[model samples]
Structure formats: C-alpha cells, structure tokens
Target: MLRVVRIAGPATLVGVGFAALLVALAIGGGAAPQLLEDPGAVVRFGLPTSTMLVNLAASGMIGALGLVLFAIPPASAAYGRALDVAAGSAAVFTVAAAFTGFFSYLSVTARALSFDDTFSQGLGQFLTQIALGQAWLQTTLIGAVVTVLCFAVRNQTALFFVGLLAVASLIPMAQQGHAAGTTGHDAAITALGLHLIFAAAWLGGLAVIALISRQIETPKLVDIVTRYSSVALICFIVVAASGYVSAELRIGSLDRLLTPYGLLVLVKVGALIALGVFGALHRRFVIKKLGDTGRRRHFWWLIVAELAFMGIASGFAAALARTATPVPETVPATQTAAEILTGSPLPPELTTANFLTQWNFDLIWILVCGFGIVFYLMGVLRLRRRGDRWPWYRTVLWIAGLLMLFYVTNGGLNVYEKYLFSMHMFGHMTLSMAVPLLLVPAGPVTLALRAIRKRDDGTRGMREWILLAVHSRAATVIANPIVAGVLFATSLVAFYYTPLFRWATEDHIGHEWMIVHFLIVGYLFVQALIGIDPVPYKLPYPFRLLLLLATMAFHAFFGLALMSGTGLLLADWFGATGRDWGVSAIEDQQAGGGIAWSIGEIPTFILALVVAIQWSRSDKKETKRRDRNADRTGEAELGEYNAMLEKLAARDGR
Candidate 1:
C-alpha cells in the first residue's frame, strides 16, 4: 500500500503543479492589464512583437510530441522509448510556448499602458503567435502519423485503432481553435494538447495494467500489477488536477454559467464524482472476490460501467472543446460610482427567488393532490404486503411525506435573467450534489421491482410494460455513459449560448427545460458514478481516470477562455445595463471562467485519491485472503472439482 501510494503521489503532484501554474497564469496574467487606465490600448500597442513568434514555436513542438506518442505501438518494447522521446520533445516545446505566450501577453498589454494602441497591436501579435503555434501543433500531428506508421510496421492492430481514434479526435481540436473566433485560442490549444497527452498516459497505463493482471500465472504477476497500478493512480491524479485548472480559466461570469458552457462544466463534474464512487465500490466489493465464480458477473458489470462512463466523458470532451466560453459583463469604476448615487431597479421577471416566496401556496396544492394519489398507492402496497389489516394509514402517510419532500425540493420556478450568482450556485448544488445523493438511496430500480411484483397478479400489462421499459435497448442506451454524458453536457451548451438561456429567463417554458435537463443530467451522472445499473461498456480504472482528466481540462479551458475574452459573447443580453462595475468586461469574463476551472478540482482530486487508496487496499486484502485460503488447505492440492464442492458447502452453511 505504501509503495502504491508512493508511485501515485509524484504523478499527481506533477499534474497538480502544472494545473496550479496554468491557473496562476490565467488569473494573474491579466492583473497588470486590468489595473491600467486604458488597458485595451496598452495591450494593443505597448507590448513587444517577438513574444508571439516564441509562443508559436513552443506550441508547435508540444503538439508534435503528442502526435508521436499516440502513434507508437503497445506491443513493442520500443513503445516506452518512443513515448520518452515524445515526452522530452513536448516538455521542451511546452516550456517554450508558455514563456513565449506569457512574454507576448505582457509586452502587447504593456502592463495596460497605451490602451487603444496596445489593443490593436496585441490582437495582431496574439493572432500571429497563435498561427505559429498552430503550425507547430500541425507538425506534431504529422509526427503522430509517423508513430502510427511505426505501429503498422509492427502489425499492432490495437495500437493502430487507438492511433486512428486519437487522430480522428484531433479534428475537433483543430476546428474548435478557430471556430469560436475567440482570442483565447492559444490557451485553448495548450489545454487541449496537455489534456490529450495526460489522457493517453492514464488510459494507456490502465490498459497495460489490466493486460498484465490477466496474464499473471504466478505470484510475480501480483508485483507487476501492483507496480502498474501505482503508475495508473498517478496518471489519474494528474488528469484530475489539470482538468480542474483548465475549467477555472474558461468560465467568465456567474451569469454566463446559466449558459451552455457553465451547465456543461457542472455535468462533467457530476459525472467525474459518479465515476469515482463506482471505482471505490468496485475496489471494495469486487476485487476481493476476483477468482470467485459467483462474483464474476458483478465484477464484469462494474468494469463495463466504468468504461461506458469513460467513453461518454470522451465524447463530452470533444463537444466541450468546440463550445464557446462565456464573457462576463464589465462594470467600470465610473459606472460603479454612478450606481452608488442611483440604485438599480430589479427586473420585472419572476426570478428563482420569487418562486421561493410562493412556496406555501404551492405546497398546499401539492399536499392535497399528492396525498390523495399516494393514499391509493399505499392501500394497494399494503394489500400485497399484508392481508387487509396492515397499518395502511401509516403507509399512506409515509408515501405522502415522500411526495411532500419531492415537491418542496423541485416545485420552485425561476426566470433565468433574475438568477443571481448565489441563486444559480444554489440551484447547481441541488441538482448535481443534493439530488444525486437522494436518488441513489431511493433505489429507483429496486422500488420499481417491488412495485411490479406487488401489481403483477392483477396488472399484467403494467408489469410487462415496466419490465420492457427497463429491459429495452433504448432504456439501456439512455442509462449508458455515452448517452448520459452527451445529454447532460449538450444540454448545458445548447441552453446557455443559444437563445435558450435568455428564453428560459423570459418564460415558464425555459424553466421547465432547465428542471428537466438538470434531472436527466443529474440522473445520468449519478448512475455513471455508482454503476448500479447494467452498463454496456467497461473501461479500466486508469482509462476512466484519463477520461476524467481530459473532461476537466476541457472545462478549465472553457472557463479560462471566457475569463480572458475581450468582448461579450452574450453582449446583447448582459450589456443592456451599461454598468461596467470598475472592471474590464474581459477581466470579469476571465474571473468567472477561472472560478469554473479552479473550483471543480477539489472534489476531483479527492475522488482520485480515494480510488487509488481503495484499489491498493483491495489488492492487499485479496492477496491476504488467497494466502489464508492456501494455508487453510495445508498442502492438499485442490482441483477445480474439490474447490467447487467446498464452495457449495460453504454457501449452504452460510
């Protein structure tokens, strides 16, 4: 366990350190510019021109190294050698790009002097630098192709397919950089590049470990897997830390979170937490019984669920890379002074707070209607559980209480525009955090099963329908990670950036969508995490960690981009107030983005650590169990036949 912990520690440290550095850069990098009287002009003309060239070179090299690593084959002993080369190259290039981008940003902004001139100059310089960086990135992609060629030379089919998918994924990366027309493309590029490499390490390492475990014919296999497990754990930590930093930098404002970008971040975070829980459960329950026949199905199910979530996370990441970051509304110092003298009036829309105020009236209606129906259901359940005289009133009251709780939690309706940052945060907490915990214990599946059993004799159609609904492929797919992640993340993106966010703010229709989307996304995210339901795919632990990391990175970048953006993407909606509250629009945008990127990491890192610890403990416990069983047998060579008889007898006794 100590050795396992040691192995995982460094990788996590490296990842966390890197993430911290990135976050620092995003937040502090703009401080100088914000303090200037004419920050825009300073950024445009005051900064130097050479920094762009350096950044371009650095981005190119890092991208190239990533490509090369992806191209190498797992079957070859040379695989590690190739990866070393790629890592070395990427390190060199990333350092160069980071310095170059930093210097260029500083020079162009001139610490926020000569605002107007700097703005134009800085924009041009930044663009040029990005173009160069893209060039390097493209070259790195070519190197990846070369690595794929090497895999082909070795006739490695698995490596080839992995390479192919890696290559295909690059399309979204390339498109996203330019598609949004946002100036934060450099940061986005860096985030995406790092994310890909880290993901590969995590997932690839897990694959290696799993393969090694399966091939273990002797005690040596245990040591080999233990070593590999350590590596995988470290990789997982890196993925989580890096992802957190990136998301914090992308989200620009609290208001923009209601937009697609914010919602997606929430969904991703939820999914990650869910995945961690599943990993813990698997390590605790399944690992100890690895060789037991009765537990094989459960083990397989857990694995499948993990993998399915990983795939879903991967797809969501792809979508995230393309989504636009939100820009915060700038409240200038001059405007702040004016607002002090003349206070602003609240908007006429019925906000979330308003809905809370009408709670009593809503509750009365819910109690009357909800209790009436619940009473009927209780009478039915009681009839089945006990013949006729079973405390039916008590059961009815219990049902009514449950409905009251549900109504109180979800009955509130709020207009989108009226939602303040605090309220929005509260809503997200309820959906992503509170709701998941409640639903998990509710055991919807178990409840449905019980209900069906009770109703089956008299209500054959209802039983068959319930069974079919649960058994259907469509239901299976909906419960799958891919569908869940996509639905959750996509809802966030679609609702926020498009007219949907504003519409939801304007009418009751939008509120309904928000509620539905949250519930669905929440359900999916939790299900993916706990893995109580059947999942069609199974990802190894390392792979799940990698996917989680990648998803977070995408989110961070999204937030950072929003924080750093010069113009408001949602200007028409947010700009109407003309209230620049002492900060530049871009600065506020960056701050909000940073918030999203940074906050999500705490839970993510904790989850990763828990997974590693759990896995290590399980491995040790299983080894000890096997040893004890061997000792108990006392030199008697037990064949499969004898083992089966002993297992049956033990079960009968239990």
Candidate 2:
C-alpha cells in the first residue's frame, strides 16, 4: 500500500494541479485568444503550463533540501534519495524556466517563428536586454547551478548554502508577474515573494516525503513527519498572511470578490484553508496513529489527500498570475510629484497624531517581528516547564525590542522616510541604536542554546545551526570588539558618503538590505560591549567603556558634518518630493543630522551605564571569592610572608 502511494501520490498532485489550472484559465479568460497581435494559441496555452511546471520543480528542489538540512539524518538512505530528488527537480526547473522565458518573448513580441538570423537575433536581445527576459534567464542559470551543486555537494553545511541560492532564484520571479507596476509595488513584491517561498516549502516537503518513503522505517518516519509538521505550521502561517496581503492589493475591495479574478483567488484561498485543516489533523491525531501498524496505511492515504489540495492551490495560483486584477495596477492618468518619485501620493501632514497613527505595514518585517516574539516566548515557556529559570525581564526586553523594530519598519517612519530625510534618520537611529540596546541584553541566543533540544542524528536543526554560526571562523573575526566597533562607527560615514544611501532610498530590496545591515552591525557592537550572548572574546569593562565613547564621538562627528554641509544627500529624492508643507529639504536634512547626533546618543548612555554596573558587580564578586579562599587556607600564605621577612631581618643584623 505504501509503495502504491509513493507512486500515485505525486501523480495525483500533478493531475489535480493541471486540471485546476485549465478550469481557472477558462473561467478567468487568462488563456483567451487576443483581439490583435496574438502570439498564437500555442504560446498562450504553453506559457502558463510551463510556468506551472517551473513552480512545481522549484518546490521539489527547495522542499527536499529543507528536509535534508533539518529533518533527515545524514547517514540515512533517505537523505541521499532526497538530494537526488532535489537534483532531478533542479534539472526540470532549468528546462521549464527556459521554455517559460521563450514563450514570454513570443507573447510579448508577437513575432512569427523563423529559422533566420533575424529571429535568433531578436531572441538573444530579449534574453539579454529586456527585464522580464533577464529575470527568466537568471532563473534558468540559477536552476542549472543548483542542479550541479545538489549532485556534487554532499556535506550538510554546504547544502545549506545551496538551499539559499535555490531560494534566491525566486526573487526575480516575485518582483515581476502581478507585482510589477502595482500601486503598492514594494508591498506587493514583498507579499508575493513570501508567498512563493513558503508555499513551495510547504507543498514540496510533503512531496519529498512521498518520494523517499520507502527508505524509512515507521519509527524514523514518525520523527521526520513530526519535524516536517513544525516547519509546515510556520509555512502555513506565512503563506496565509502573505496571501491576504496579495489578495487585498489585487482585489482592492470586498465587493470585487464576485469578479472572475477575485473568484479565482477565493478558490486558491479555500484550497489553502483545507490544506491547513488537514495539517492540523495530522498534528493532532494522524501523526500519533502512524506508529500503529494497523493505522499506517490509513495515514499515508491522508497524505495523498493533503497533496491533492496542495495541487489545487498551486494550480489556481499560477492561473491567477495570468488573470487580470479587478483593480487596474497601472499608473494614474495624472501624477503628483510624490507619486512620480515614491510611486504613491503624498501622505497627510506630519502632525504628532498623524505620525503616531499613520502606518505603512511592511509584510516582511511584520512576519519577522511576529515570529521573533512568538518563538522567544515559546523558548521561555520551555525553560520554565523544565524547572529552569529564565529571567522575566529578558522576555520583556526582547518583546520591547521587537515592538520598536516593528514600529520603525511599519509605522509612520516607514511611510514618510522616502519623502522626508528626518523621518529616515529617525528610523535609522532607532534601528541601529535603540533596538539593539534592548535586544542584546535579552540574551536570545543564550536562551535558545539552553531551551532547544539537542539533536544527535547527524542532521543540523535550528539550535545546531545557531551554535555552528556562533563558533564559525568568520563570526570570530567580525564579532571582535574592535572590528564590530569599527564597523558600527564607520558605516555611518561610508553609507551616506557612498551610493548605498541613494540605493536604499530608491529601491525596495535595497531598503530592506539597509535595515538589516544597520540592525546587525548595531547588535554586534552592543554585544561586544554589554551583551549576554556568548562570544569568542570580550574586552575588559574599562576598554568596553572606551570603545563606546570612541564610537559615540565618531557618530557625533558624522552628524555634525552633515549638519554643517551646504549640500544635501540624495537631493534628487528628498528635494524632489515636492512637499509644500513642513520643513524645507535642506532644513529637513539638517534636522536628520541633529537626530543622528542627539536622539541616537540616548542608547549609548544606557549602554555605558549598564557597563559600569556590570563592572561594579564583577569587583564585588571577585572580593567575595578572595574572602572565601582566605577562610579555606587558614592564613598559611600570611605565615609564609612573615617567615620571609624574618630571614631578611636576620641577614641585615649579621
């Protein structure tokens, strides 16, 4: 029965997915013949089909690697089989991406097929010169690289890097499709990107289990399934959240639910909800029953049922991409200066009320902050249940840090940062200084090292990976007090003086990278000074104080330079926002500099004070240790010292 399922399960998924895509295309007119300049029915139908294949292939590659890295033991036969599955999937992905790219060119150019140089030349230009073409081309090349690496690399650590590359291949695809040129283009891209990655991980994992089921015993299978269930739970949450954001952007209103495109979204949503319900059942009941010989067959059949729903969701998703949105995603007939520059209209005036109330939620940060808080609480709960004490204040501090980060990334600061330099600087200050001050002392890494169960199955789980990263050679260098301090202080000058500041302001990906860069550097520097987490080296308290003071001075210098400068940074962006209200552009820039100098120093003061307290406590502890030693030794060291003094005095008398 298991063998039959191993073969029939994936077949059912592909069949169901293909069927759903056809039905959705028919209903939404996604594959309909164009009124003019049609790329032929072949290109129209073939493009969606091939694109769906690309998605399925991508799922298999990522899912298998995820299981190998976290779930399956390296010595097990199933692990190698899973890698084989990933390799095979990558090959399929490569071919499918190539076809998708070619079909895309045909659709766009509406050019007839030919055997001449003109045809070859146009196709080459499309692949090399055009944005859509370049995206697909990059996908194909990445797929090819991943394919080779999966076959050649067997080390668990190496495969982790390969998995990252596989995931990155999806970025270009996420940026295009329904996300490009949308009103909330950045949000849409972030939403769609999260949706694709998590959905692939969820669906692809189950498929991998089916493919490698024969290599595992029931006992081991139960463990793997349990681990997979945890991952799927996370994937489900992210997928649902991102899907909501994507659907909201495309549909715009509840009334649009009756439209064809909206109905297709509803279909996909239903399928996802059903999959989620099935996963819950597995976690609650079926997983436990799988260890029973009599119930094992029944459990595998349920797996097949879950895969069918996944297929339905996947199919409808691909079709929806090709379908037109109910709300037009195009630019307006007339544009405001704010719209022209930031791709959105100028927000309401920046009153205290508006600043506190207005929000532009970044989907990525929302997930990051949400998961961070939940997982930290869970770790604390685990420690308490085990009769191990974790500080309540640490929990509070961690939660506070995440909340501040959430506000900086998703609140009013995010909304106006593109238009106003002061807002951007305010956010940068909070991200680099305030957030780290709260987060570093929380000792999240210490908690995780204590709370998470140690896995000895030759497979690296989250705890193991965290440990490896902490002790890695690269980590040793960068986490050094001096290096971290230098990076923390110099980044301010380097970023603003270079092209990075402009890139961060103008590009969505760049902006996200900028936030991450600042946050990481700040955390490292603070950790070097007063962090509770384990590190390779720590300076004495006095040097730590000196380092903090030095960094503080450098930060002030940078801020002063900006304040005194006649020229504005990214004048094109800040100066061009065309705001008639609030401060002028140069004044706003100066205010930002003032923020950097003054508001950013608040965290430095807190850090220095904390260091002093720790230093005083260390001295008291050392003194207590000496007192205890004196009592243990009964003044023998004092007697030896007196005898030496007596011998010296007798020699002087002679």
Candidate 3:
C-alpha cells in the first residue's frame, strides 16, 4: 500500500489537475468568440492552460514552505524535503508565469509575438509598465526569488519571510482579475486575493502531506496529521468565505448559475465540498488510527481523493478566469472621473444619515474583525469555565474598539473617504487613535496568555507565538518609547507628504497596508504608554505623560501645517475627484486638517487620563503590598532599621 501510494499519489494529483483544467476550459467556453478576430485557437486555449500551471506550481511552492514553517518541526528531514519541493515548484511557477504574462498580452491584444525592436520595446513596456502585464511579471520575479531562497536559505525564522514573499506573489494575480475603474473593484481584489492565498495553503498542504507520506513514521504521522488538520480547518473556513464573496460578486444571482461562467463556478464548488467532506472524515476517523496499517491505507486513499478534488477546484478556477463574468468586471467605456479614480459612481451627497448607511465590505477587514471577536469570546469563555473571572469591562472595551474600527473601515467614513479629504482624515483618526484607545486597555495579550493552554510538545502554538512576538528583537525596537512616539507622530506626515497617500488612496493593496500601519503604530504608542500587555518596560508615569504631550504637540503642529498650508496633498486623487456635493476639494482639505488638529487631541487626552489613573492605582497597590508585608512579619525590617541607627549613635557617644 505504501509503495502504491508513493508512486500513484503525486501522479494522480498532477494528472487529475490537468485533466480537470481541460474539462473546465471546454465547459467555460475556452472556444468562445472573442472581441478580437486575429488570435487563433492556441493562444486562446493555451493562455488559460498556462495560467493553470502557474496556479498549480505556486500552490505547491507556497503550501510546501508554509506547512514546513507552521506544522513540521524545522529540524526534521521533512522540512528540508519541503524546501526542496518549494524550490522545484517555484522554478516551475517562474517559467509558467512568464509564459502566462506573454499569453495574456496575446489574448488581450490579439497580436503575435515578434523579435523586432518595436516588439521588444512593446514587450518590455508591457512587462514593466502596464498593470495587467506588470502583475504577471511581478509574479514571475517573486517566484524566481522564492525559487532561489528555497534552495539557498535554511534558517527557520528567515524562511517565514520566504513564506510571506510566496504569499505576496498572489497579490498581482488578484489585482489583474478586476481591472481598474470597475465597480466593486476593491472588494473584488480583496476577496480574490484572500481566496487565492488560502486556497493555495489548503491545496498545497495536502499535496505536501501526500509527497511526504513515505518518509514519515507512524508516530510523527499522527502528530503531523493533527497539526495539519488544524491548519486545514482554518484554510477551509477562509476559502469557503472568500469563495462566497467572489462568487456573489461575479455570479450576482443563483439563476446565473446556468451560464457558462456560473457552471464552471458550480464545478469548483462541488469539488470544494467533496474536499471538505474528505478532510472531515480523515480528521474524525482516519487520523485516530494512523499507527494501524489498515487505517493508514484508508488515509492514503482519502489523500488520493482529496488531491483529485483539489485538482478539480484549481482547474476550474483557471478556466473561470478565462471565462467572462455575467457582469463584466470593468465598467462601460464612459465613466465619471470619480468613477475612474474611485471605481464607483460619485457617492450621493454626504449626509449624516448616509455616513451610517453606506457600506463597502472590505473582506479582509471583515475577516479580521470577525476572527478577533470570535477568538476574544473564546478566551473569555475559557476563563469562565474554569471559575476564573475576567473583567467584563475589558471585553466590552475590546468589542467597542473592533466595532469602531469596523464602522470606520466599512461605514460612512469609508464611504466618503475616497471622495472627501475630510472624511478620509476622520476615518484615519478613528483607526489610528480612537480605536486603539479603546482596545489597548482591553489587555488582549494578557487574556490570551492566561486562557490558552501551553504546549510543551515542541510545537509552537498561538500563545507561544504571541509571547515570542512580544519579546522579539524586532518588537523590542518598534515598541521602544522614542521609536513608538516618533512613528506615531511621523507616519501621518510622511504618508500624506509622500507618494504613499496617492498609492493608499488608489490601490487596494496600499489601502490595506495603510490600515494595518495606522492600527499598529497606534497600538504601539498606546502599548508603550498605558498598555497593560507585558512589554520590555513601561515608562514611569512622568515619562509616559511627557511622551504623550510631546507627541501631541507634534501632531498639533502637523495638523496646523495642513490647515495653514495653501497646498493640497495628492492633488491628482483628491483634487481630481470632481465632487459636486461637498465643499470644494480645497475646503474639504481644510476640514480634514481641522479634524486632525482637533480629533487627534481627544484621543491623546484620553491616553493621558488613562496613564494618570494607572499610575495612581500602581501607587495604591504598592502601598497595600507594603502594609500586608508589615502585618505578616510585625514590622521586623522597620525595627531592624531603627536598631541599626541607634547602634550607630551609641558607638559615636562611646
């Protein structure tokens, strides 16, 4: 059975994956009529086929590395084998992505490649200059880098960065899916990006397990299966949720499932369901008996089936990319400037009611908020079950903070942010300041530390990871009092004054980076000051208060500079939005400055007050500890001090 699994498992996976791709292409109309008439059968069918290969290879490369990082012990032979697989797979991805990019050009423009200088110049321009072509090029370059790193690098922690680079290679894939100027463009990018990443993790992890089955002994197999199962569960939920969002955006309605694109989607979904069922069965029954040869046979059979299903899912996905969505991914040729810039119709007049009513569900943020609330509640429950009391106030504060962040990201602030500078600033303040204020006092790290059971089996669990992060050299530097203060103060100015403001405003990837940056910088500053989470050190109250005031002054000066300045930041974005409902763009800029100048101070004041309260409480706790010690020993240390002083005086008198 072991020999059969070893020879057939990988072969079955590759064969099935390619076979499924061919079938989905036929179903999804890889033969469909094109807007252009010049490109022939090879370019049409070959483009998606190559793309399927890219996806396949990328999953194998990324999933193998990630599993090694997260589940397998770094010192094992399995780890080195995983890296070898990643290196081999990434090399394949590099080649495939380069071809895929060239094919994309052929498909989109219906042009044949030539070796002329004109053709060479155009190809270079497309690769380096055009968004769609640039994405594939980036993917190729990233894959090449991963290929080399997988072979060259062996350090475990450094490999985590390699894993991250592998994950980021998909960002361009997500971006090119929905071209710029499409309605729901940001949401589509977010959804598809997440879908690609988690799907790869899920698909690749299983493939790695099949690849490594022969090398793993029974005891290690049991442990590996259990750990990978947990990762698989997380991947399942994310893939399911992101798939739904992408489907809803593209499919639009259940009736549309009858269409070619929808039919391809259904094929993918069916495969996903089968995969989920197989995974559940493996976890529920098969994994418990890995040591038994009979159950091991069953497990390998399940692995084969799971790999086939993954192939189906991956193949259908590639085909779907080539298929036209029921609704075109891009808007019609005619569009308002606002639509072109912001990817949606100019928002209706900004009203108080509209702020609360408007929504742009950034899927990444929704997942963040959702996971945060769920995990927090779980921690609270864990504490409660053990007859331990966690402060209700802390939970409320945490929820409130996350909800505030949700509203700022998805609510009215987000709705108007792209159109009005004032709204953008308002949302920024909430995310960077108000939200952190509410959340910092919640002491999330403390709760996680107490609630999560420690793992002593040499497996780094979530709690251990959190602890390592808190005390890591990187965290130590970032969380330093001066560094945190400087980052908190300077990020606002640096972002606006630099190209970052333009990038964040226009690109989904940059927008997400902005959100994370603001939140972390805010959290770090608060963490340094009033944060109850364990840190290397918290400053004395006086020093903390001084730091707060100094940053406040810097923030005020920045806001004042904005208010007093005659210039507008990101003139092309804010200045060109062509809004009619709001005060002119210049006035909106001034309003943003006012919000920054005033609203930021409110959060600073709150930080100061929290610091003062914590300081007073610290004094009270110290005094109580001293009095309790005195009572315990009848003030023996104080009496000893008094006797020593008297002995000194007596010696002087003699």
Predicted structure 2, TM vs. truth: 0.97
Model 2 regions lying over 4 Å from their true place: 292-295, 635-654
Q: Whose lDDT is greatest here?
A: 2
- Which candidate leads the pack in TM-score? 2
Candidate 1 regions with alpha-carbon error over 4 angstroms: 1-426, 451-454, 457-466, 533-540, 577-592, 602-654
Between the candidate structures 1 and 2, which one is better when assessed by lDDT? 2
In terms of lDDT, model 3 sits at: 0.86
lDDT of each residue in 1-654, candidate 2, tens digit only: 678887888998999999999999998888999999999999989989999999999999999999999999999999999999999999999999999999999999999889899999999999999999999999999999999999999998899999999999899899886857647989998998999899999999999999998898888899899999999999999999999999999999999999999999999889988998999999998988886653578778988999999989888888898898998987788888888888888999899999999999999999999999999999999999999999899999999999999999999999889888989999998999999999999999999999999987777889999999999999999999999999999999889989998888888889999999999999999999999899999999999999999999999988898788779888888999879899899998999889999997889889999999999999999989878877899867777899999999999999
- Candidate 3 stretches with Cα past 4 Å from truth are 32-35, 113-118, 291-294, 643-654
Q: Report, for every candidate in turn, its global Cα lDDT versus the true structure.
A: 0.45, 0.92, 0.86
Location of the lowest summed lDDT over 10 successive residues in candidate 1: 46-55
Model 2 gets an lDDT of: 0.92
Judged by TM-score relative to the true structure, which candidate is superior, 1 or 3? Answer: 3
TM-score per candidate: 0.34, 0.97, 0.95
lDDT of 3 by residue, 434-528 (tens): 99999998999999999988866555677877888888999889988889999999998789988898889888788889999999999999899
Better model by lDDT: candidate 2 vs candidate 3: 2
Ten consecutive residues with minimal summed lDDT in candidate 2? 291-300
